[model samples]
Target: MTKNAIEVNNLTKKFKDFTAVDNLYLTVKEGEIFGFLGPNGAGKSTTIRMLCTLAQPTSGSAKVAGYDLIKDSAKIRQNIGLVAEKMIMYDRLTAAENLRFFGKLYSIPKQRLEERINELFQLVDMQEWKNTQINKFSTGMKQRINVIRALLPEPKILFMDEPTLGLDPQTTFSIRDITRQINQDGVTVILTTHAMTEAEALSDRVAIIDHGKIAALDTPENLKNMISQGDANVFGTKISNLTSELVNKIKSMDVVTAVAQQDDYNLKISAQGENALNEIIDTIRDEGGNIASVTNSNESTLEDVFLAVTGKQMRDQATEKATPVHHRHGPAPKARVR
Candidate 1:
């Protein structure tokens, strides 16, 4: 059996009689890109905070990089780095200044730290912007520097909480590429994201959490296969001259379980089993419907598995209290984890 990079047993977090993470258990292998995916306020960030030792857990136990979550928190912090949902850099600082400041926090040698910082900036193609203050940079440029700052410690593990959240497509892909390169260099990565597309693209394995519980945990392919092995199918279809007659024809098909009109020219069809697509198109044509597009992709998708497990509820049951807990604050005088 492969040794685990991180291990959790019955981990739980409660805030004022409300459980944020309830009896959660997970084991992430070393050098694997592990994804934690869920909707907003699904305890993804809360879990990371606990593991990173930013927030103390209410109960249960975990080991990050062989250090105890509770007892060896300082050691764990020493071996790990974080790219939080919110940027960690001070906007008034230059890119190089921000990185040097964080690098010094880890007590790295001044000479070696400077070399590492330059290498990281070069790796992200941001060497030119190193002297510029963060407030002067675009969102993408700021995010790039923020990512490299996390790398200053040369940590064995990296926890990225929505690293590409709200980023443009180009910036998102750039971050994704950098994440892949980090994993290739033997760093284990734990990523949390709401975007299934990003999760599917980067994760070696994923755990989908809802209501502060593990709904499903497996490789993306396996999760998708779970949906494919089930009875229903999901397909995207487009038709020219779409009419009530054509829509009704598709709904009437024995193979089609249901049909929802996405637009005047498009329909989303849910059906069952092997030959549903062929039969759907056949019925559409028989009804004199002009076909513009018919996609019969049998490959399973991550969103399908998420829907099957989580349904449509995005609300968190445990932390639904006085104020919406988009974030959970730690004990007073919370120091920045550099």
Candidate 2:
């Protein structure tokens, strides 16, 4: 079996009476880009902080980059680069200066540090702006510099929290490409993001976290398949004025299982199969309901999986309260492991 690059067992953290993380377990393989997904208050940042050795886990044990999270935190820190969600760098310093500062902090030799800085500038496509002060940089540029600074030490593993949060589409694509390149260079990456599309695009595997625990963990394809399996053949029609009588009449059809109104005009009805669509239409027509447009709106996606599991969209769940809890033993909950 391949050895894991990072391992967490029963990891937990609490702040006062709130539990931020509860019995979280995870395993990231060497050279894999593991997407750690969750809403804003879902403890993603807290977990990354512990893994990066910036915050100790309140309970449980973890091993990162072959170093114990508690007993060998210093060693762990040396082996992993961290890019926090918030951009953190000196505004007065030039991008190149910031890289140099981080290189020195990591204790890179003077000669090697200069070479590494040059490489990082090229890696992040920031060589042209190397001499420009960070205060003059755009949000995307600052994010690129933040990542470069974290990578200065050539760590074996990287922890990135919302790395592309505020970036434009073009810049986000660039960052994603760079992340893939880094992983190709044999570095393991642990990333946290609320963007399902990004996770689906980049992760070798993804962990869906919610309520301070994992709701699902698997490859993106597998997670999406879970939602697909739950899908029923459904037909949606837009009517001028949907009413309770019309809804009940549609639900009473032989093939229709449920009927829901989208608004005053649109009605969505779930049916058993394709044949049911004709039956639904016949029934609606008999009732003198005129169909303006019909379409299938229940297509499965990563968003559907998230919604099915969390009962909310990733963006909406970000504002919920987050409580901290101590870690629990054993593997994390296996929702959709396949």
Candidate 3:
């Protein structure tokens, strides 16, 4: 039987009058790359902070790495690694120096630490640059180091926050390959990202959070199917002489749920009810739109699912309240595992 790496139940966080993570319940199975996606200010960061033991929750409970969230925080810290959005390393230190500094804090034995450092450097293909100063490295190089820094402690679970936020295409691909390799080595990963393609390609299961709550949770394919196979109808059309007026008219249609301009001549639309596509075509003809082509594909992207489920809801207004929680077990060691 597969074990669970993380379990959360009604985990809530509030700051004064505002709630950040509102009654969230979730479970991440061992050895799976779980995706945690949400729009801005949707409490993604706040929830991660609480699970990482960087912040405390207001109510409810959780178990991370089989340790109670509140009582066994120190144990939890020892068993997990964090790769935050920002790189955590010293600019002046060389790659090897930085890794050594962090490894020492974890109190790894001298010989074991040296072997682990070499193994990690080879895993990320950074052996040649081990002695090079971090200040001279490019963004991608720095990020690669950041990833391995989090692994020095040999954690069971890894929390990666926007692991590929601002990298070139090649670098992003390399990082993603590394992520898969790490997962294959039996490290459970909880990934929080805004990139739909990344989440769809990497996650075994995904949870979409909106307005401080889970709006949809399922496999990427299942979530997309909810938009394509359910009541919603997705249409892709191109007009040679597309105009803003025509786009506005389509948006005004009672049946149209979303009208996005792919370009000056192409539009992706979602609608509902019977005869909706025929009505859309008729309206385009009446409005002098020069039809180029149309396609009704059964396939849907994760982005489409995200927009369909959370687009119509009012935009999130609550700011993540960063309240520091005093841990009886003491704060996690700085840069020890992140």
RMSD in angstroms, all models?
Answer: 5.4, 8.8, 3.0
- Tens digits of per-residue lDDT, candidate 3, 121-223, equal 9999999999999999999999999999999999999999999999999999999999999999999999999888999999999999977799999999888
- lDDT (CA) per prediction: 0.83, 0.79, 0.90
Can you tell me which runs of candidate 3 are displaced by over 4 Å? Answer: 239-252, 259-266, 281-292, 312-319, 330-338
On residues 197-219, what C-alpha lDDT tens digit does candidate 2 reach at each position? 88889999998888779999999
lDDT string, candidate 1, 1-338, tens digits: 77899999999987786677899999999999999987666777788888888787778999999988877777787899899878989999899998888877777888998899989998899988889899999898888888888888899999998899899999999999999999999999999987888899999999998878998999999988876756677888888899987787777777765465668998767678678778887888888888998776556577667755775333643443332322232333333435
Q: Give residue 306's lDDT in candidate 2 (0 to 100).
A: 63
Name the 10 consecutive residues with the lowest summed lDDT in model 2.
Answer: 329-338
**Which candidate leads the pack in TM-score?**
3
Model 1 worst lDDT window (10 residues) = 323-332
**Which regions of candidate 2 fall more than 4 Å away from where they truly are?**
230-294, 297-299, 313-338
TM-scores, each model vs. reference: 0.80, 0.77, 0.90
Q: How good is model 2 by TM-score?
A: 0.77
Worst 10 residues of 3 by lDDT: 312-321
Ranked by TM-score, the better of candidates 1 and 2 is: 1
